[model samples]
Target: MRTLVSRLAVALLGLTLVAALAEPVPAQKRGGTLTIVRPTDPVSLEPNLETTAPGAWVYFNMLEGLLTLDEKMQIKPVLATSYEVMSPTKVRFKLRPGVKFHDGTPFNAAAVKFTYDRALHGTPPARWASLAGSLAGAEAVDDLTVDILTREPYGPILRTLAMYCMGIVSPAAVQRLGADFSRAPVGTGPFKFVEWKTNTHVIIERHADYWGDKALVDRVIFKVVPEEGARMIALQTGDADMVLFPSPAQLPALRRDPKYTVHETTGIRVVFVGMHAGLPPLDDVRVRQALLHAVDRQAILDNIMEGSAGPARGVLAPGVFGYKDMQLDRVYPFDRARARALLGKAGFTPGPDGIGGGQGAVPRVGHGVPAAPRQPAQPPSVHAGLGDVERGCRLLALRALPFEAGAAGRVEHVAV
Candidate 1:
């Protein structure tokens, strides 16, 4: 009797929290529309087809995932009332009983199964199918009970489900709309899709029948202002409430403004350069080591990033799963003598004309070369061309180099 009462009390508490969230926002903090700007438009609004952040920025408002990450990055249930690991490769979920999609269809275990099936094996596979990660199948055992089976005992399953792409959608709406579903998204979230004007803006309105917390704003407008100056101007003129990823140079002015607040949050993005070790000069290991010793990573981080960025170790950032820190002392040290010696050992030395050349020598750039320091240990050959540039410009610069340069690519999702 005691155990039964405790379980019932916990269920009642959860219901109370849900009911409290459904109440309207207080009059003092309600009714205005919030407007923001993005650097570019989303490729597609359909959660399954889109693989970019712009799409996620808009869709997140209109969908609810089975699980969600809290401010501390811990997994917490959203659509799912509770879940249990039935076995090494299987899991079971108990759905919240009264939730409904924006279009009036009931939200249940069946809807969850349908969403995952469409994502994994629909007419065309979802763009990020690998995000499911070793999942073999999901099935509805009852209206509110679901069983998920994976090919292995995947530890990141809860985190994967928390991603915006895994948000559940109304099966009836999806079947009715087919390919057009991208434009007519229907889910159980605080906001409902209103309209999207290509290259211009996307609009969403508060869902009055939302199962969770009511939206604080009446509407949200995501406008596309590609130019950095234009985005700042919009914020200054009160045309936009927020702007995404403003350039580093703009921070000083924004930080000093008394009327506005600046929010600097931790993110998990890393930027690094890749070398083509198979090509001519780079094919030599000594040449690669020489180049690594010739560059100053700290100077770039301080001057170009204005101190917002940190020098990269390996490819992965700190605190990510499986990350092992590279010992800085053991890695290549910035020594000009060592770089020159390596080049000479590989049969390269400076000619009378002052340009570095010999058998198998890497060509040297003359202009903008920093004067060699008095100490032989200091590197003076690192190029200024390395500072942040556009994708097209970076590719062009790389192609123009004597060595082959690859285009910049984005690093997708990360797990912990």
Candidate 2:
């Protein structure tokens, strides 16, 4: 009987210990330090006054917006707990209680009013100031509720406010800091700003008393690394946990290693070369066209740019508005003879093999060879089949007579 009782007691204790271990323990929240490299530093942090997009992204994560967009690009709640659309142009928010700014200020209707009114009445060039113009009125329905009236039926009303640029600010912070908010800001976000070194880095630490679901990571270290080559090296060397823009030149080296996988998210950026239009050689549209025909875009794809870029079709990238793939088959091929023919037609007559004519009807320098032309005055159109190749031909067309014969019209690789 004694032996049985002892065995039973041991079993009971084991089960109790197992139960205790299995019981849901709160998530063990430990702070982590994440280092990221940026190509450039942010110009400013004042939400209403910030113009640069990259800096704004950092600022957005640090502040609360009434509404926010998820990965699917749909509108969702952020600072406001719940909201009701009273009319096409009006909204009422059920504010979340016990929310505090980084500076220990209460987030309320007055805070919203302070941010909006200050932007509207402060300066003509408030970062994104005109949003204040749309507000008809703002009033607190109660201590934890607020109503907002707008001037018009703004489509994507929630989405517009949800943009990263429109982070909410603390009224108390504004009152306390005044104009210096540009140098320092207070926000209700997962991380609070600790300090910044110009063109070097910015550090932020997680908020322990975050109102909603707490953040998984603790601290973020932001560093500015300009070169893609440097960014790749930094990642490999443990200097950076993340790199924003891996330069087009360094894609091959990154793919060779299997221990780390590259994470890419398609973004809304058009990385086209901005043709300077004010130069001389570029004034001749044919030279621009010839150079357009001159480059091996396929070569750029297979070699220089490699996996970093897709075949750029137009000003807008693959997913945005005004994008088309009609020009997929439209490209100037690599035939030296055709390139020479286009130059000849433009009155750029060449001797023997081919080169620009000296001292021709076109303006000439001391050697009778015309200097490089100036950039065209007009912004080159991004219409189908128009590109840097076309722009390059325009730059060289005026130098020789062989290029001028029928150069007024598009011919060969070069076209105006």
Candidate 3:
């Protein structure tokens, strides 16, 4: 009996020890407010009418389309459960069931058709019409099936549909709100529009009854802080949870600080110097080719851009579909010797008097080419305040004209 009692006591002690040793399970973080800083406020909450990236940034959380682009630019399913390309000109989509707009309107094939019809034929038409590229029409096969037709074999139709402008809106809400829809947008998204004080800030709240995954954050605030310095200060002072478009100058310091994380990605836009081929000297193919060869793109990237910008090889970036790999060195060989040889071949002989054309010929100084049709002239205020042109003229006067090759058919330290 004593042995039995001792065994029960030991078992009771083990149970107590087990209870004491076990770690407590943590509760999931479900509710918090996130504040984002932007240089500008969104022009409109309605994705279809919005054009600016700042507008899209805000609308993306409140609106969604049948498809979305992944990091690799590949199309991924969103509202649509599955899709099949029937032919080059036709595609079919199977919509996800039980999805409803914020206004409680059903999200169906009818909604898709209505959205596309408005985009294609509505007054003030969609800005992304070019992306849609010859969209014939969209038809509802049934409540959940949609058939989309293109005029020809349009390759970018799927991508176009994935655009923010193509986001499906409630037909009932559009009818009820009419022109006021931009102020109060209602969509089947993770977030619902709350208020947008134009030029100041846009606020959104989490959709509690969201169809798919629930949003972890309770609210999101997009505050406009135009100045980059102001944005950095906001981040430092904990006034902002996140900031967009921090200046490249501040990146080194931001990266060094352990309190924050810095992310870098190649941008979609390309910035290149444009010269008028219709103008004198530039009209010559050899002169144009020589100018390209003379530019040290690597040096410019390193020194001016602080290695933040990448040298553009082709007209389009590499990730873009149908991009062709070109040997950049062969095309624009960054060789001053080659540039001098090419310039001489084009009959551009620099004179002792520091002119590029010939002994008596001088460079034309005014606007090099005719302005485009309907181009407006500078305002009197702008013309009076302009100092850049004078500075440019001074720089041009100081620059040495492209000189001719000597013994080795190579010129050194030639400036333009």
Candidate 4:
């Protein structure tokens, strides 16, 4: 969750790595307006028909992407100032000659082949086709050059063209505001798009012909405030200069409040707890390894993320790019007697009111924190190892909402 590019790189680089190791690093001053405070609102400023992270924290401050990353996550080149890997299904790039697109058009190579041929052929399809589903199109090779192609040999094609749905828009402002260019968005980025208001707020500004090193904030806004106690009371009443998911029980009183600065990091977003494995008691692989050894992933990273997250060993969260350590060969530790001996070897034992009597209910679907400290620690630690029989495997719902309405109600309750 933390990472609106590390909170706008510490609010547009006032650069404070603990005040550059304690002193002598001050002079950065430039313009002003910052505001932030988001918890929702911003489903599309059209970066390839965005897929929420609040529309990537406002089209990543108005979009640009011809590869990006760095902060040591490697892969650079911005509106493609260089690229090559031109064979195993091609690549090429090269653009960046006096870039433009804040709607005065001309960012060329046919606007990166009309923004990847309108996200590989648009009209209700672009969520950048699930991260450029191995692209396979895009040409141009002249104006400033371009190539792209791919339907194979795609080793994460330059981190999927540095994400934010492979940005690069303004094919003449999407052919002169077609679908109203997704509510008036246009880009080359370092801020531009200036107005949204929908669930109240989203601004942007700067970009005075920006082509690099220019945004020291002359407007940013964002501000939706969908309550984490009203975005910490709009950052303690000065009306927020930055706030996003702040309230892991008031983060130790906002880190002992010295006018607040709480910027912790490491979050590539991964919070698991998925199951439906072809139903019938999760299609028994010893009852899905006894519900991953009955909860307690370090007691949900110490009582529901107050230790600020770190127990997800898989689904790629530890600094992303092909993350591994899938707990190398077996290790699901919290053994409630090895989850009741793998639910009595998937046959469901325990009766005389100790529960698992008829063995069929394992529902537990959740969304964002607060379900009374995960219902007294994950369905009472897997219904105290499957012996609670009021419909055995319990804690069937948590629903805390607002990450795109709890991921569209967990994809319509996993498609019913």
Q: lDDT tens string, model 3, 176-241?
A: 999889888878999999988987889999998899899988998989887768976776677876
Candidate closest to the true structure, highest TM-score: 1
lDDT of 2 by residue, 212-313 (tens): 877777888778876657876776677766665454444444434444333344444443333333344445565445434544444444443334444555
* Model 4 TM: 0.32
lDDT digits (tens) for residues 1-416 of candidate 1:
00000000000000000000011224447778888876778777878877666788888888888898775567889999899999988889899889999999999988999988888887677876876788776899999999888889999787778776888889999889887889769999899999999989999999999988898889999899877678767766677766664545656655565544444443434433345555555567876676566556565544544444555554554534444557442486656677768767776666564444576234322211111111011112134321111011111222111122123332211100
Candidate 4 residue spans exceeding 4 A from truth: 1-34, 39-55, 64-106, 110-135, 141-166, 169-187, 190-205, 210-217, 221-227, 230-232, 241-279, 282-354, 359-391, 394-416
Estimate every model's Cα lDDT from 0 to 1.
0.62, 0.54, 0.62, 0.63
- CA RMSD of each candidate after superposition: 12.3, 16.6, 17.3, 17.9
Native-to-model Cα distance after best TM-score fit, residue 282 in candidate 2, in Å: 15
lDDT tens digits by residue: candidate 4, 266-352: 656554545556656666777667666665556445554445455556666557888886771157766667866776777776667
Model 1 residue 343 CA deviation in Å: 7.8
TM-score for each of the candidates: 0.72, 0.63, 0.69, 0.32
Q: Which of the two candidates, 2 or 4, achieves a greater lDDT against the reference?
A: 4
2 versus 3: better TM-score goes to: 3
lDDT of model 2 at position 234: 76
